[model samples]
Target: MSVLLEVQGVTKTFGGVVANQSVSIEVRAGEIAGLIGPNGSGKTTLFNSIVGAHAIDEGSIKFEGEEISTFRVPVIARKGMLRTFQQTRIYGEMTALENMRISAPEARVSALSLLGGFSSKTDTRGEELLEFVGLASKRFLRAGALSFGQQKLLEFAMALMSEPKLLLLDEPTAGINPTLINGLIDRLKQANKELGVTLLVIEHNMRVIMNLAERITCLAHGEVLASGTPDEVRNDPRVVDAYLGAG
Candidate 1:
């Protein structure tokens, strides 16, 4: 498969602290790539730089063969890329379906906040996506009232509403109940297989990452520690010492 996203020699700093230094990785089209690291390993910083949430001090970021290191978040997003947060970002007062509809690129952010209005087409697609994410029954509930896991499901559905080509997920299973994880994993794989979306997921749950990712990359102290197939990365001494065993 072709490379969908390429990040090379990237570095970032805040004040004098180096958050990421000379990091490099790639995500291929139609594959689930895992990113794992210990706390403060610069995993999130790398995601920020790739998605244009933060400016990198150096190196290149390419999506679908074009350099995007200089692009801002919206520009990158418009190019069919989107990122989900570790903490679900949904309007607390909005219903699950409402949250999904307003996330469309053409939807006016503030207008939706006040009116909660959506087109019939957007509503239909939103409802379908909600059902796909296992929240169809809760479509009428306010987002804030949902459990953390349910809120995350809603957030995932919202991102799907955009039909993103490359979706960057940050710690997707962090606080969710373990029992619900398999269901979420199945949804992610279905999205990748049926919808043809490329996923770059950051996850700490060893079992989840091991089973979900076709390839795995491990990071430590702001640098690439290991990268390969799931078993290869999982068995690497550096990875085990730095993250796996610790987890």
Candidate 2:
């Protein structure tokens, strides 16, 4: 498989607090890699640094063999690297179709032109995308009117609008019901299989991460405790010490 993302000696510090300490990892094309750690292990901070939300005090980040440590968030996103937030950010007043249309880069012109109303083409694409996330029946409803799981699905669909090659998802299945969580996993798997999009997920749910990630990276106090296949990492003594305890 082709390498899509590389991080070398990445470190970020906030005065006395070290957020990420000499971290390094790579994500290959068409793979789902899960990152797990305790609450303050710097998983989110490292993600923020990668996406330009925070600057790296040291190290470099590369995408498709090109150095992108200095690029801004929009530049990185335009380069086919996208990051989704742990918290879903959708327009409450907008309909499900409208929400997808807003982030659809290719649909921008048609969407803006139909500011008065949605055109048939826009409606179709939006509806299709909604259907992709099992939200087709809710297309006409307001985004905020949907349940937490539906909103999460909408957020994923909106990210798809960017046509990303590498997707950074922070806690994608968090705050959702168990039934809907499985659906989210299946959708992500389908995206990876059909679209060949690479995924790097930061999820706390052990079972979810284990089932989805081909390789799992465990972080502890801003350091890598273990990195391996789900089975290996799950049985790792250090990883267990860091996150799971003897049981």
Which prediction has the highest TM-score against the true structure? 1
Query: Which residue ranges in model 1 land beyond 4 Å of their true spot?
Result: 108-117, 244-247
The C-alpha TM-scores of every prediction are: 0.93, 0.92
* Reference-based TM-score, model 2: 0.92
Which one is best on lDDT?
A: 1
Model 2 lDDT vs. the true structure?
A: 0.86
TM-score of 1: 0.93
Candidate 1 — what's its lDDT?
0.91
Worst 10 residues of 1 by lDDT: 108-117
lDDT of 1 by residue, 1-247 (tens): 9999999999999999999989999999999999999999999999999999989999999999999999999889989999999878889999887788778756634445646555788889999999999899999999999999999999898998988999999988889899999999999999999999999999999999999999998999999999999999988989988964565
